[model samples]
Target: MIHPLNFDSLLFGYPVGKINVDQSWDEQGFLEEAKTFQLVYIFSQSELKYSSETVRLVDIKATFFKRLDQSADGCSSLERPNGELDQRLVKLAFESGAYSRFKVDERLDNEEFEKLYRLWIQKAWENREILSLPEKEGMVTVSIDGDSGKIGLLAVHPDSRGKGWGKKLVKAAEMQAKREGAQGLYIPTQLDNLPACHLYQSTGYTLSQKEYIYHYWRN
Candidate 1:
């Protein structure tokens, strides 16, 4: 069945919908239904065979998780942003989403991709949940729900890639999560994004889940 995505439709200024299908789904019928929306997101546990019109946006979505049994290091160096959002932070946010499906789908305008990340950072900052490491090298946004915590966005500037800022920001997020009484933290990234996957793996996070994501754009 197809479900309309209200927020996504509003954000992109067009009709958007999503379909969660299993291996037994009807491909021809799915395509017919997909054509009703401007954009349709297809999610599946295993890959699905589709016509050329459907684009495989993410081959694998890898999610990592780390328990918060022990206190995390590198918290001292992280600072919460005050007042206006830093332009550098906005740049970092945009860089963090370079591998996102929004950027990968050529159908979406480049300006919309930038606007999406920009507003993401702005909302995180306004909520005062953003943590920035020293010198604006990297930043992470952490949020808590019940006993779980999530890393909303984590980014390290391209110029500071090799300096271990990404790991530090991750540690800072963990520390923040522990302080908020969360039992564990979850971070999700595209499997094709090797650098992010490596960073999370090297920082004590283990692979928790994997799924396939596809996009069907109405012509």
Candidate 2:
């Protein structure tokens, strides 16, 4: 028999009839992690607003149209539990630049790292598709200026839409950069992503500059 409270486990594809029980500590940690990422995602945009109607836990299976076991997941294995790859990627950005800039050596603890991972899973469980680089296909971060840096390949899961997490994430990144003494952070995305534009604007990030990114190659 499944406990009603355990229905959320079904969000992750736990069998319908089985009760999903977890340690209190695990639950607490997961919530904290989710809150942190949620905060980051919520804060990233100048225009993206937090709305309960937009951000809600959804059926992962319904959106994927497959068993939870079948989806192809991509994430940064830089942390244990290893799914909230976005956080890791952002952390990597800070590490690559912050280390060079501040000369500070810091890493997230196992618990903190795991918590971050759980946040990713929660977003997925809510139906968002995390678009990261192909596995083992090295990703890159570039310094934008003396006071800024940028990361490519950032995305929210497909199923988790309408929550304004995108803007939140941008805001959080900006805050993180400022705390680390960065004047700002920069990102480039297609102009068609109106939602993204609204998000960036709502969160105090602006369209400071744009340029043509031409990819010419001889094959």
Candidate 3:
């Protein structure tokens, strides 16, 4: 079945929908149903070999999870911003999504991607939930629900790539989650983004699951 994605439609100025189907789904039937929407996103547990019409956007999304040490103290170096959003943070947020499906789909307008990330950083900052290094060279956002936590957006400046800022940001997120009484934290990155995968693995996160994401555009 196809579900209309109202937010996506509004963001992209076109009809957008999503389909959640297993490997057993009939390809012809799925394509026929998907044609109703201008763009349809299909998510599956296993990689799907589809006709040329369907574009495999993200090969594998590897989600890494780590159990927090509630006894450990949270990081004190990260600070929450006050007042207007920082343009630097906006750029960092955009950099963080370089491997996102939106960026991978060449059909999508590049300006839209920038606008999307701009709004993302703006909202995260306005919500006052964003954390950043004292130097403001990187930032990370975390969302908590009961005993669980998830890192939303993480990015380090291009000039500071190899300086271990990303790892520090991850550690800060863990500490923030622990302070909020979260027992564990989860973060997802595209499998092809080896740098991110390596960073998470080195920071004590383990692979939790892998999924396939495909984009079907009906022009």
Q: What TM-score would each prediction reach against the true structure?
A: 0.94, 0.33, 0.94
State the local distance difference test value for candidate 2.
0.33
Q: What is the TM-score of candidate 2? A: 0.33
Report the number of clashing residue pairs per model: 0, 29, 0
User: Which digits, one per residue and each the tens of the lDDT, describe model 3 over residues 75-191?
Assistant: 577899887888888888988898988887887764667878888888888877699977778899988889999998999888788987888889888988888888999998899
Candidate 1 minimal-lDDT segment of 10 residues: 50-59
lDDT digits (tens) for residues 1-219 of candidate 1: 889999888888888899988989688888777777988888898888876656565547899999988747666888998878899999989888988888888887736688788889999999888999778888999999999999988988788789878887888888888888889999989999999999999988999999898888776
The order of the candidates by lDDT, greatest first, is 1, 3, 2
Model 3: colliding residue pairs: none
Which numbered prediction scores highest in lDDT against the true structure? 1
Q: Give the CA lDDT, 0 to 100, for residue 79 in model 2.
A: 17
Model 1, 60: alpha-carbon shift in Å?
1.9
Return the lDDT, model 2, position 91.
44
Q: CA lDDT, every prediction?
A: 0.85, 0.33, 0.84
Q: Write the per-residue lDDT of candidate 2 for residues 176-202, one digit (tens) a residue.
A: 334444554666644444555565566
